[model samples]
Target: MEQVVNMGFISIIPSLLAIALAFATRNTVVSLGFACILGTFLAGQGIMGFPTLIKTSLGTTSFAWVMLLNTFIAILVAFFQKTGAIQGFSQYIQNKNLSRRAVQLLAWLLGMFVYFSDSFSPLFVGTTMRSISDKARVSREKLSYIADSGAAPVSVLVPITGWAAYLSGLAVGIGAIVTQEDAMKLFIKAVPFNFYALITVIFVGLISGGIIKDFGPMKKAEDRAIKEGKVLRDGADPLIGKELTEMEAYPGIQQRVFLNFILPVIMIMTIAIGTYIKLKSAKTMEAFLFVMIFMGISMFIQGIPFKEIMHTMTDGVKGAVPAIMILALAYSINSLSKQMGTANYIISISEGFLSPQLLPAIIFLIASVMAFATGTSWGTFAICMPIALPLAFSFTGGEATTLVVACFAAVAGGGVFGDHCSPLSDTTILASTGSAADHIDHVKTQLPYALICGGMALAAYLIIGFTSI
Candidate 1:
């Protein structure tokens, strides 16, 4: 075990520096890297600690799995684009000639359907629907909002997903839930109470279906798109470059758009779920790997040159490299924080305020703040779960499952809530890239909606906290 530093309040500096730098510079990699270095120094590791930092950051089995899963998904997305599968599907939708409202609704629906991975969902749905949504006069901001909201929120609610696997593992690790089965059961039970996720998902439909009128920046974006025919505001810097935003189907090839796109996705879901059921665990990474292999084979069979295919896959991997770097840095910071006892320090500071009637609300709010600052829901889960779960067990005297469930729900929901709004979040960035929206524009437009849902979720948690007690 790594030695834990007894740094008390000083331990928070690394995280605070990271958060401040991220907000100030809008560069996650730089902020996280600086923070990691500072944290290692503070932990009494000498300058040579850089080697230890790298090893600790990427050496773990869990981290490797996450990296592979994300990288493979990126490759798969590249394959989809290269095969003209995404474009073909977009054309099919265009041929249907659905109304603007219907196109928006379809984009929203596709987001929910692609609930396997949060990062993959937005990249797929946002990129696939960008042209269609643009034609409908939907602002890139709005498209990104729909994509971002749909990604994490839906992933958290669904059981057969990487989010569920990670959450379930955390729950079991807490030892409050003895078995993975029971931990997953608790996760499922908590799903209904994941108000932020549930509300965010429903809110997307409300906005898309025109049941809820736009109230803030989103309204202005929609208006600009409709009246001025500006999909992006004048001089806005979009996250995606022209090469990707304007990528065309490779010329002179038979494009079986559906076959190219749908088959691999279907295979991924089918095989992932089947393998999980057989092995009594989630095979998310394995499933993605299989899908990538299948996609490569299918493309070769379809007469796409091996060289061009390799080039496209490389481009796709390149596209995902930014996100992967963010993930690595996020993980490194989390590790450093752990070594410095940041979570424990925070828990200690807050422990005096804990009460059964207020635990859920407090946990929710804290987790939300942590995730918002860090821009990593998974990291928030890693930090908060160990702290929150034990507190719930002790506070409830180990008997009130309802309270435990509520607290669990709060942590999970809060992470998603913060992730939805955080500009530094991978999913948020992917949404902007996928929709060809300016990163800050996407953040600005989505904040109001996320806050609204977060408010509702906060109210619900308070009610559950007080009433259940």
Candidate 2:
């Protein structure tokens, strides 16, 4: 009877509502906002007391924390751009005179270099490598594809990164079922199974620089770039792009582009190294915070003056306005959904959908669906971990290392796939806007590739499940 009640409550209405908002408005913030409201409603009042939902649902920590973090990250990224550090770095890469293929390969190589500093990976790589990819006529979607793919996957796969440490903590929290060392080992094993990320790296190399058929919308974008002999889309020069244009004129300006570029790189590296060494650990939030501070300092020293620093931060905040709101909304939905017992409700309804022999496949499907619906890899992991890990751990007779690894891989792949397709995703929009490609074009071109990778991962999961069991 209790199980039945939990099942009815856990159907995930809050998540559904969030998904609806995202699609309806085609805005990530709006989708998240609606989801948060739904979560608050669930938490503050029973489903029956719909009228008082708004008044009661005002307090939730998830909404607040996610907003704060988003605000900070956005501001830092914007300030880095305003300081001309990005341009300096891009110019340096272009100066190398590498062929387009060489440029694409270099971008992949650099992503590996910065894998230890997860938060800095996207910004740092995007800041520097996008320039060369642009010059070589790689589409913005492809460049972003490379950047996003490498950032989190590489960070998490390596135990040395902040992400690895974060997962370790999650493992510890799950308690008794798996040790920290075991969790780390499982995480390492899962990397080879992360089909989306590994394949993305390979696809970037093949599709860019004319190695394979660019048959979809991506091919069109590529063709246009080549004919024009430029990286930006027609009428969309990188220098004049809105994000880049806002900070072109500033103080402490380095005439030597190389100096402008190298300084930021050195500063970011210094912060990451310093934090890891000073703390004798890799997982502090301070590591993230310190990197932001160093990034800001480097920009200021490069030529952005104190006055501009304030503006840069403000600009950063403005960029994050949408992302912060969406994050809050996402958290709200989770709070409400869990409060209402929505996840349990769904599990009950779907109980026995997979036989005990097929438990691994069912777990993967659940993780993927949740991730795709929520548009967050971390959220998917957090929610599923509490339920899936415990159940799998119990089912496997306390040896769930392999199952945990599979589940983690599923969520990771699903999240990236969602981000690739989610028109409301911040990274998706940024990739389009950054690369001077049309927003829809990036989505359309990348969707096929993401799907392909996802399929491969699923097949891999099945193979591993059957063999390991």
Highest-TM-score candidate? 1
Instruction: Summarize candidate 1's per-residue lDDT along 1-469 as a digit string, tens digits.
Output: 9564557977778878876786667566788889888878988898977569878778998678766766776677678777788778878888998987898888899899878778678877887898888888999999999988889999999887778888888988564588888889988999989999999999999999999999798999999999999999997867654545555666776778668888787887777668766765657778788778888888888888899888877776676666667677767776776677766666666768888888998899888877775567998898788778888888677753788899999999999998788765778878887787877778878998899999999999889988876
Task: List TM-scores for all candidates, in order.
Answer: 0.87, 0.75
| Number of the top-ranking candidate, with lDDT as the measure | 1
Each model's lDDT: 0.81, 0.58
**What TM-score would candidate 1 get against the native?**
0.87
- RMSD after CA superposition, every candidate: 3.1, 5.1
Lowest summed lDDT window (length 10), candidate 2: 236-245
